[model samples]
Target: MLFLKPPGVYAPQDDTSLLTTALHEEPLAPGARVLDLCTGTGALALAAARRGARVTAVDTSRLAVLTCRLNARLAGARVRALRGDLLGAVPDERFDLVLSNPPYVPSPHPQLPRRGRARAWEAGRDGRALLDRICSEVADRLRPGGVVLIVQSAFSGVAPTLDALVRTGLDAQVADRRYVPFGPRLRERAAWLRTQGLVAAGVEKEELVVIRGEAAL
Candidate 1:
């Protein structure tokens, strides 16, 4: 799907390819229990709910949570939107499938568009803050044979992400990818793109890497 939107947009246009692929790959499957992490605009949860899944979406921003709740109500989907960072806000619970499109931009700039701790596009100090944490905790929060799907950017390269998830004992796979144009920080990622054979071809350093893996049983 195309996820086009205005620049510096607070929320993403689409729910990311991982969500769409997950829906196509596994789908709601009757009464599936789903968890959507960092649900910026509730797209995944709402979509899954439409497919007959009971979804609970969590975000760190109150505005995001409210937006999602309102959208869910409007769409007549049984989706719960809660405000919380990562998995803290929700009570103890497990789901058949867990999904997230966490903040993946790695930046050295102090002043970013969304500067809030959890709302920022990139995790602070090497950009591995939230991704690492999520990988480490997913195994425990997931049920037996549960699936964990995350959409991370290849900004800093996919190797780091693959290594980290593998280190967490999850068998990772790149389910899908998309080439996006550089919006704000095009120059910053030029060198990295060159290594990936993207820059010399006039392609910008914007891309999405969707990963799928099951929690250790």
Candidate 2:
């Protein structure tokens, strides 16, 4: 499930840097309520925090949370990092902006990516299980007009993810997108990649979907 020797820290990968940059580009308020899901090493959370947002970052790994706090302090970001899986740690919190780069690998077998956090890189066979859960639950924790920004693989079939959002009944659209390279492959994973037209797409510069529909009524 772990790929790097320094498993607890995020030393900057291509995708990671991309996500961080996107956060820097968001037009959030100086004191925006921000929620960062599966916050790895708190990179995005830290970025948002530095922008003056009251950021709350969540991660299931104890090491990850600690590392996030460390990263935040190193970056001088005022972020609240926690050790909890998904939304477990913050059952009663709502935010103006929610961000996550969840696990979307579609494999029945339980295996971790050899590059990033293992828990942050694996999903069900369709790779939509966690993404589905997050999409559906996000509305419950977002204020009206709030935004949910996420990064998932094109290989997971972007359409299905959008369907999940529609099924959740939230208005959403792809705001920013870019091609990202597939790091490695698991059994049949490449086939799934091809099915999504990602194998030839060469990882596909994923995206940051912005979701904020007319009040989740």
Off by over 4 Å in 2: 1-5, 8-11, 108-117, 185-217
- Report the lDDT tens digits of candidate 2 across residue range 81-200: 888768878998888888887777766554544444556667766777678778778878888777777777665667766666667667876655665544553433666656754455
What lDDT score belongs to each candidate, Candidate 1 first?
0.71, 0.69
lDDT of 1 by residue, 96-204 (tens): 8888877766655434334454354766535566787788777667777788888876765577767767777778788788776675544665665466554576666
Name the regions of candidate 1 deviating beyond 4 angstroms. 1-9, 14-18, 110-118, 185-205
Top-scoring candidate (lDDT): 1
Q: Using Cα atoms with residue i matched to residue i, what is each candidate's TM-score against the true structure?
A: 0.80, 0.80
Error of 1 at 39 (Å): 0.4
